[model samples]
Each structure stands twice: as structure tokens, then as C-alpha cells.
Target: MLKFLKIFCASMIASALAFSVAAKEPECTFSATEVYERIADNIVKIISFSIDQHRVLERVRPGIGSGIEIEPGLILTNYHVVQGAKLIGASTNDWAFEAQFLGGDPVLDLALLRVPFYERNFVAPEFGAYNDLDVGQRAYVLGYPLGVGLTLSEGLVSGLDRQIPLNTLSWTTRYIQTDAAVSPGSSGGALLDDCGRIIGLVSMISSHPQAENMGYALPIDSIMPLVGEIEEKGYVSRPWHGLYGQMMTPLIATLLLTDPASVPEGFMVETVEPGSAAEKIGIKGGFLPVMWGFSEILIGGDVITHVNGQPIRSREDALKTVGALEVGDVISLTVWRDGVSLELQAELEERRNFESDLWVNGQR
Candidate 1:
């Protein structure tokens, strides 16, 4: 009887423990007021200063932006905010702290700053499950807009995996689109979920008057992995092969006014960045430029038939294969040049900066 009693007591205790654990988990949903109250202190104001030693100082009005505290003493902001700044600072209503630029990636528009002595008193934010998020979910934006005080705005997620073009170069990082009202200074702010967890980093807003209220943010899920690498090495080591082009199709041949049979179906090499792996492998780019739709395409370059052993039929396939590669990895390419098939091999290298190269269609 005593043995049975003990076993029953143990079962009851286990049930109670399970209930306790479940009760400790915070609710997945939170009200707007609850979210603001929870994460208000996590948002910060960024000050960017451009110093000229030659000029006598009158009054230096710094550029204003927003940032979010990712960890104690570590703040994350847009790279453009502090891109060429001589000095940077982070501020709250009470305390102003001098910030040091730790490391950043221009392509991702992410920068990490460190406030040497400041320690956060509030609880660290939990990252929202980005994969679980769906369209029409509640999205709250917290930032210092127009150099004014901290503001909170709420809206629904309008879209996901949005690929917005940045000048001549296409933004490789897909952004999350929200209807939340973000302004000039709202860059580098936090885009929070209903549970007060960060899901995206507010980057830019639609500048066109017709497209008002459209704000885009970098997915926090993508940035989180790069954040660790930046913390470790001061920058993201993105692999660079320096081959930029579009996939040759029947439509392209039609647009080029060439016979479809003569132009092979493969990745058409447009321009290879100088000193890149593609150039090292003796790959050639097109010399004849033709207007295809809104964009210009070169017609006389080598067509990549295969990479390693896999067929290169679409641009997506090439991107997937190259994106999986790391620096120093060897790659073999099969190219068709003037009715001759040539096999070439090269090792990948690290991409440091492509901001200046963007004007020349430098995307790899």
C-alpha cells in the first residue's frame, strides 16, 4: 500500500511540474501598450559626425539615426548611418554614450556598435520566430523618427522576401515589407512582433510619394547568423567569384535579334570584375551591348553550360550553387565560347567591399 501511495504521489508531482513549466512560458501575443513598455529602453538614438580637420569648428550638427540594443553595451544600427562618420554616439533621454564602430557589412546594411562602459538594465530581447511569421501578422516599429523623440507605430506585415533594387545592383538580401510608418531617421530601428520580440531591423522606406507608408526591414533571422560572424571577425566574409550575368534564354536571343539555336541556353557572362576568380579562369564578357527591355545586355560573352558537374540552366541554380560555396573552395566551370567548349577552374575569394563597384554592375 505504501509503495502504491509513493508512486501515485510521484505521478502527481510530475504533473504539477509540467504545469509549472507551461505557466512560466510567456504568452505569444501582447498588446501594443504592453510591447512598447517592454522594449522602450532597448531602442536608442544614433548620432553620426563628419569631422573636417581643415575647417574651424562653429557648431557641428550630427546626422541622426536609430539603433537597437542587441546585447548589453552592444547596439546594432544601419551601416549607412555610420558609414563614413568620424565619430559616433548612442543616446537615451538620460544618458549619452560614445559608441565605437565594431564591424559592419555594407551589403546587408548592418553595423554593430559598442558602448564601452554602459550596461543594460532591462531584459535582453528574444528573437521572434521569423519562419513562423505570416502575412497580416502584427508588426510594430520602434524608432526615433525625423530626429524627434522615440515613437512607436503599429501595422500589419505587407509582404515577405521582397527584393528591392539598390541602384544598379540588386539587393541580394530579401527584405520584409511592412505598412508601418518609418521615416528618414527611423533607419536601424527595431521591427517587433506582437510578443515584443524582434523579427526585423527597419532599414528603409519607400521614398516615392505614391508609395507612402511602405517600409522595408532586413530579416532579423538572416542578420542573426552574420552578427555572430561579425562579433568574431569584425566583418562578414562573403564569398566572391566576381561573375555577373543573366541566364541566356530564347527570349534573350529574340531580344538580341540572334538565332535561338546559335545562342546556347546557359548563364550569359556579361562582365567579370577585374582580378576576380572569373577573370583568373580566362572567362570572357560580352563586348556588344544591346537594350533588352529596360536593362542592357551584352551578347558576345561566354555562356556557362555547367558548374562542377551540375547543369546551369537558370540564374537561381547558379546562385544556389555559388551561395553554398565558401572562400578558397575550388570550382570548375564549363563555358561555350565561339562554338568551342572550354573547361576552367578557379578558387573563390572573399568579397571585401563592392559599394564603388556597384556603378559598374558589380554583383557576385
Candidate 2:
């Protein structure tokens, strides 16, 4: 009788442990149809009326884009969509609500808007880990294209940590590249996982006729850090280096008429923004434009070898080193220019809304 009771207790304990382990595992994976059905209501149509710069008489130009609700009444979209908007509105098929600009970060091309009143108790979707996503994993894009009804397109993740130049400026940030079909009105839409969790925000696409199914999204991890600041402070105060350039390579050295071994590998400084910290420290922009393959590159600029005594080797390395800086922090740069090496120092300052200005002026 004693042995029988002991065996019975052991069996019960094993069953309980098995049940606990199973309960801890995630099981939210849904079918493709279910993902769309669940997320469609949260996807919204963004309409904006802004001043037209091209017209001699300033006229209100209407624009349409897509938005994703991150909270009860908070919408997140691309900053370029409503940069100089006189008025902005968001709507679903059921109801329309007026939206006010909460804040924006032009550097990241992200903006947050607030809706004063909402009809239903909206539940925001969960966010997935962007790092865990494999290159060939399934990805879905949900948005309104050309003011048509909400659409869903499925594709696979093409690449990661891509540095594509969107608009006129080459933004020094990471973008997740996918083969998903993104269109004119798809900006600010959500790149979702199988469980209907947002992994990225659709930002831009390669519209060249030759380029097919090339779309890019900003990873959600990059935006998570700025959410609180953007909500409270109205703008993300980014640490400004205010310098733009390409990474120096052996090919770039050859184009610049220099020996590959003679030129050090680093971030090649092409231009310094006017009135920027780099400008204050006497950094110079390139004047001579030479064709490097299909792109035009300037040669006579400073090649940054190190930042704050940290060796700058790759674009990722440079961004990682400088990205840790904050405004009011003093930074030091070691650059090689005109066959000479120089050390420059400057106190970091706020980057102006130059990107917004360029967009509003129709330069991009």
C-alpha cells in the first residue's frame, strides 16, 4: 500500500510539470487570413492637407497615406507624410476621427499623432523581435494603396541591416529590406509577423522600373527607444554629427586616384551641414563629383579614421560608436584629408529639421 501511494504521487507530479512547460510556450500563431482580419481595423487611412510649394500661390495639397494605431488613440506614421500639414485626419471604414500632431523625429522618418476621441476600446497589437526574424521568414504588409481599400501582400524577408539612401539624403540608419509589394499609399504601414505582431514600419521603396518588389521598412526596435521621448517632449533630440559621407573602400580609393594601401578605410566625409557641430569644428565637404559605378561620389573630403579614440572600421562600427553620444557631450574625431591627418573636437548639438525643410520645399 505504501509503494502504491508513492508511485501514484510521482505520476501526478510528472503530469503537473509537463502541463506547466506546455503552458509557458507561446501559441499565438494564426493563419494568414486571421492575421489580416485581426489587424485590418487597427490599420487606418491617413489624410493630410498641406501647402503646395510648387504652385506660385500656396494652395492646400491633399495627401493620403496609411497609419498604424500603437495605443488607444495614438497613430504612428512617416514624418514626411504630414510634415507641413495644415490639417490631418485618420479614419477606418466605420468612423473618422480628427488627429493632431503629437511629435516627430525627422531623422528616423517617424511621427506620432493623437486622436482626441475614439469610438471603441481599441487594443494595440504586440511587437515581435526584429532580431529573431530570419531572412527567408514570411512577412506581410497591410496598408491602403492609392486610397483603395485596405490590402494585404505577402512576401519573404529579403535582407537585414540594409543601408539604402531614400530621398536626397543618405540617412545613417538601418532598414529591413523585403520583397513585399509596397506602393504610394503604403507608407507608414505595418510589417507584421505570422502572429500579427508588428516587426517593422514600411518607409520607402525602390520605384525604378527595373527594380521589382524592392521595399524597405524601419525595424520596430529602432523606434521603441524614442516612443517615450516623442510622446512627452514633442520631438526626439538626436545627437547631431551633421556630417554625411560614404564608407571608404578599395574601389573608392581607386576612383579618388589614390593607392588602396595609402588610403585608410573609414567613413569618407562628403559634406558637412551648415551651422552644424562638424562645421563648427572646421570639417569640410567635397567639391569634386566623380562617378563611382552608377553613383556620383565626391573625393576631396575628410576620411574619419576614429571617433572619441575608438577605431572606425565599418559603417556599423561608426554608427555604433557615435550613436552612444548625446547632446552637449564633447566628441573627438580623427580624420585624414588632403594627404594629412587631423584631430577635430566639437560639442554635439541638436540636428535641425533640415530633412523636413527639404521635403516641404519639394527637393526630395
Candidate 3:
């Protein structure tokens, strides 16, 4: 009888442990249909209207894409989708409304629109933490592909921290690369994680006609700052230091005649705008052009070690540091020059019309 009692107690304990483990396990896996059902109401179809060069009211050809409701009556989409649009209309599964173009960030390919006095309440998607996402994680793309109805496609996070060139603006920006099938009409759709949280907005796919399943999305974190700016100021004014550089590697350091092990990693300055903050502060740009592998790079410029006491480790780090500053704010840079290290200070300037400025400055 005593042995039987002991056996029953062990069985109960084991069952309790099993239940606890099951409770602790995460519910990361989810069904596609369930995700669509939850978010379909917030997904919208955007249509643009404008006048043609012939001075007639014209429906812009292929002026359709997808948008996500970020706030009540406010939707987010791609700038290209609404560019030159005189009138905009948005529709969901059950309702349709006229949308007003609030503002846009062309560089980031983001546009904000509002459906004023919208009667129905909107469910804003929960933004997933971008930094927490990893490659190979399951992802879903929801949009109106090729002017069809709302569609959902599944893929994985194929890459991260990708810098792709925006051919329309002739500038490059970071993107979240995925293998999700995104087509022309799918631009500005939601790229959702397994939890149905939006991690990115579908931007574009590989330009090659034969490229299959290669799509990219603009990470939501990179757009939040611009969104806040647009919400408050109606536009984004990024702080500029008039400096451009490449992240330093061991090979780059050796090519510059520096001991790779001795100096800390940083960005090697390649260009400085004339009469700009960098030039005013005596920050030298590269003088000699050297062929590094297949690419030609400028050498003999200062290696930036820190910005405002924060270590400058990558191009993203430098951009983030400068972007956080307001116009007229002073920033300090610790640089390596002529085999010596020194710190310099410069005031930030507002960068307006970056594309025109890039053209004027002869920067690619």
C-alpha cells in the first residue's frame, strides 16, 4: 500500500511538471488565414487620380497599391504610389473613403494619408521589434498584388541591414530583405511576422524580370522617426554634417598604412562638401584614389573613431548619431589623421532636398 501511494504521488508530480512546461512554451507559430482575418480590416487599397498633360481629368494608369492603417483614419503607403496624385481614395473590405495626402518622405519611400472623419474605428497593427527579427524567421506579405484583391503570401526573412539603391532618387537606403512574393501593386503592403505584427512595409522587388521571390521591405523602425516628424512638422528635416565615409575593415586599415590591431574600427572619410561643417572644421577628405579589388576607393582621409564620444563603428552608426542631432547642434568627432588621433567639433546643418544637393555636390 505504501509503494502504491508513492507511485501515485510521482505520477501527479510528473503531470504537473508537464503542464508547467506547456504553459511556458511560446505560441510563435500561427495560421495564415487567422493572421489575415485579424489584419484584413486595417489593410487598404489606395487609388490615385490626377490630370494628364493634355489638361483633362485622367485616372493615373496603374495607380494602385496597398496601405496600412497606422492610426485612426491615418494610413501609410509608398511615396511613389501617391506621387503627383491630385485625388486619393482608399477602400477596405467593407468601406471606402477619400484620403488626404498629409505628407511624405521620398528618400525613404514613405507616404502618410488621412481619411478625415472616418466613421469606422481602425485597428492599428502592433509593430514588431525590428532588431529582434532574425533571418529564416517566417514572414507574411499582405497586399493587393497586380490590382487584384487583398492577397497573402508567405516567405522568410532572407536578409537584414540591406542597403539598396533607389533608382528613382538615385540614392541608397536600408531595407529589410525577404523572399516574399511582392509585385507592382503590392507596394506599401504590410510585411508581418508570425505573430501578425508588422515588421516592415513592402517596398519593391528585384528589378530583374527573371528574379523570383526576391522582395524587400522598408523596416518599420527606420520609418518611425520620419512618421513622428511628419506628424509634428509635416516633413522630415535630417541633420547633416557634410561628411560621407565607408566603414573601416582590417584590409582597409592596412591599405591606409595603419596597424589593423592597433587602431579601433571606424569609418574612413571619403568626401567632405566644400564650405560645409566638415570642411569648416578642417576634416580632410580623401586625396588619392586607389583601386581596392573591383572598386575604386579614396584614401588619405581621416578615420573617424567616435562621434560625440560615441564610437563610430559602421555607416549605420554614423548616420544614427548624426540623425539624432538637431540643426545648429554642435557635435564632436574623434578622428585618426596623419598617424595621430584628435577630436574636432562642428555644428549640424539642416539637409533640405538631399537629392538636389547630392546632384549639386557631384556625389553618386
lDDT of 1 at 262: 84
Candidate 3: give its CA RMSD in angstroms.
13.9
- Evaluate model 2: give its TM-score: 0.86
TM-score of each: 0.77, 0.86, 0.76
**Of the pair 2 and 3, which is ahead by lDDT?**
2
Worst 10 residues of 3 by lDDT: 1-10
Residue pairs clashing in model 1 are none
Model 3 regions lying over 4 Å from their true place: 1-27, 50-62, 165-174, 208-212, 254-264, 271-276, 279-300, 314-320, 337-343, 356-364
Point to the candidate with the largest lDDT.
2
On lDDT, the stronger of 1 and 3 is 1
TM-score, ranked from best to worst: 2, 1, 3
Residue pairs of candidate 3 with colliding backbone atoms:
none
lDDT of 3 by residue, 34-109 (tens): 8787788888899887656764554354378889988888889987788768888998878888888888876666
Where model 2 places Cα greater than 4 Å from the true spot, the runs are 1-29, 53-58, 117-119, 166-171, 355-364
